[model samples]
Target: MSSPLRLILFDVDGTLADSQGAITGAMAEAFEGAGLPVPPRDAILSIVGLSLPLAMRELAPGQDAATVEALVEGYKSSYMLAREAAGAGHSPLYPGAREALAELNAIPEYLLGVATGKSQRGVEALIAAH
Candidate 1:
């Protein structure tokens, strides 16, 4: 007999919303906050799917590892600040996102939960905003 599956796990970042603009903006703010030169927004966009620290390390290659770590922290700080100031109004759900979720929720056999590297607070905030 096959094991029953009761849940559907979704990847939250790009799968749920287009966060690239906000993410890149926050990265730019982080660079300025850290007194480092801001990298191109297109450069930042290429790293969107990564977790913060790994993206920083990859994007800021040739910087000291410790400094990269600090930059990551700055990025998180800037992101959270921007998030608060933006008041959860940004990060709209992707086209078809709500309709799809509603359709899935209507199915008795389906249960939805996200499997994401985002912190619980961040995920909750995102979902609530949308």
Candidate 2:
């Protein structure tokens, strides 16, 4: 008899990878590039699960749409540059994450996937890097 499949979905940021450094760094660069005050680290982290456009709006409320769009683009470019520079080390996996994924993969009944607010390209880069 075939075993029933059990799917496991892991969050890309915070859960599988400790991406706070990259996230906060990109946020700061984006805000600064827009001539806006950079938010506190805690504030930036608070928006981790939000999509980039939504996060940008939350961070820079009351701004014109152009400013919000600029922040989003700035963040995306900054993050991409950092990822290119750092490669796999851009966002190191949390301790034991590699082992955990391997262990799960070894189980025939288990299937793993990622759920994240990141763009498809961003997720692809992360996967390719690791």
Candidate 3:
């Protein structure tokens, strides 16, 4: 008798990868580039699970569309630059995450996947890095 397939989805940030530094730094740079006061770390972290546009909206409420869009673009640019500069270590996997994933992958009944607010490119980069 064969076991039923089980799907396991893990979040990228704060779960598989410890990306708080990259996230907060990009957010700060984005707000500064947009000439806005940077939100505190906690405030920024509060929107970690949201998409960039939604996150910018939450962080900079009442801002016009153009400003919000610019913040999103700035964040993307800053994050990409940081990632390029730091390479795979920019957002390293959490300790033992790789081994855990490997173990899970080795199980025939378990199918592992990711559920994250990160962009497709970002996810790909993380996967390629580790």
Candidate 4:
């Protein structure tokens, strides 16, 4: 007898891919561009699961929503520039990620899903590369 199909959701940030470099690098650039003091790496990483704007707000307190929005957009711009410069290949898969994906995909009973804090474009780019 076969079991019923089930969804297997995976988080992208640190689960499916190690995007720390692009994330932190872009965030630092954004903070500098916005003239806000950069948050520590630990602090930034702690909010990895939050949406970009919310993460920006937490990372940069005492700032109006407009500034936070600007910072978020600045972060996206910086990340995109860096990604393009690097051929958008920075978010390499973790060990065995592709193999795991393939394995899961091969199983007809499994439905793979990605849940990440990354932007839609970011996710699309990563999927395109992978």
Candidate 5:
């Protein structure tokens, strides 16, 4: 008899790997690119799960929609450039994560996947690098 299937979804940042440093750097770059003051690291990290536009809105409250969109674009560009510069080794996996994942993936009932706030391209690149 075949085993029943199960699914496991993972978040990218601060979960599978530590991308906070990269995120902070890109966020700062984005804010500067948009001619806005860079928010503190805690403030940037707080809205990590939000979509890009919404995150930009929270970062630059009271800003108009156009400004938020520009900030989002800048963030995306900075983040992509950073990932391209560093690659799979950019973000380190949690300790023992490789062994754990291998153990989990060995089970016929388990299937792992990702559910991150990162753009599809970002996630793919991160996966390729790390």
Candidate 6:
């Protein structure tokens, strides 16, 4: 017999959290630091669900492997710095974010977990802060 989707996996950015401002701001910083052009906010936000390297590649086309690696590292560093400056606050949860999570957690049959491309540390920090 097939089992139900007892586990609900949610993506972090733009899904669970309205993190467009923070992520796009950090991307701008990283691009400036790396001497790359900053993409539009929509462009930056569009790659939220992708893996780190893949996101970097998608956002920064024509980027060779090494440049992509550097961009990814730069983004991580910039994001962390921005988050710290912004008090490491919880990213703005979507409209039903808390309610949904609470509702799911309250259920005896459900388990909730995030399945985003963010680093383990980042996701852990987000959950802890939330």
TM-score of each: 0.85, 0.98, 0.97, 0.93, 0.94, 0.85
Per-residue lDDT of candidate 4, residues 76-116 (tens digit): 99989888777536877899999989999999999999887
Quick one: best lDDT, which candidate? 3
lDDT of 3 at 69: 99
* Candidate 3 C-alpha error for residue 73, in Å: 0.3
Q: What ranking of all candidate models by lDDT puts the best one first? A: 3, 2, 4, 5, 6, 1
Please give the lDDT score at residue 24 for candidate 2: 97
lDDT of each: 0.80, 0.95, 0.95, 0.88, 0.86, 0.81
Give candidate 6 misplaced runs (Cα > 4 Å): 1-5, 88-90
> Regarding TM-score, does 1 or 3 come out ahead?
3
**Model 3, runs deviating above 4 Å:** none
Winner on TM-score between 4 and 5 is: 5
Say which prediction, candidate 1 or candidate 4, comes out ahead on lDDT: 4
Q: 1-130 in candidate 1: lDDT tens per residue?
A: 6556589888777788777777888888878877888888788878876788788877787888778878888878877887777755556678999899999988877889998767788888898776
| Model 5: CA > 4 A from native | none
Model 1: how far residue 55 lies from native, Å: 0.6
Backbone clashes, each candidate: 0, 0, 0, 0, 2, 0
All candidates: CA RMSD in angstroms?
2.5, 0.6, 0.8, 1.4, 1.1, 2.9
Clashes of 3: 0
Query: For residues 37-78, could you state the per-residue lDDT of candidate 5 as single tens digits?
Result: 999999999999899888988889999988898899898888
TM-score of 2: 0.98
Candidate 2 per-residue lDDT over residues 1-130, each given as its tens digit: 9999999999999998899999999999999999999999999999998998999999999999999999999999999999999999999999999999999999999999988898899899998998
The number of clashing residue pairs in model 1 is 0
**TM-score of model number 5:** 0.94
Per-residue lDDT of candidate 3, residues 1-130 (tens digit): 9999999999999999999999999999999999999999999999999988999999999999999999999999999999989988999998899999999999999999999999999999989988
Off by over 4 Å in 4: 1-3
11-83 per-residue lDDT for model 6 (tens digits): 8887888788888877888778778999888888888778879888888899899888888888889888776
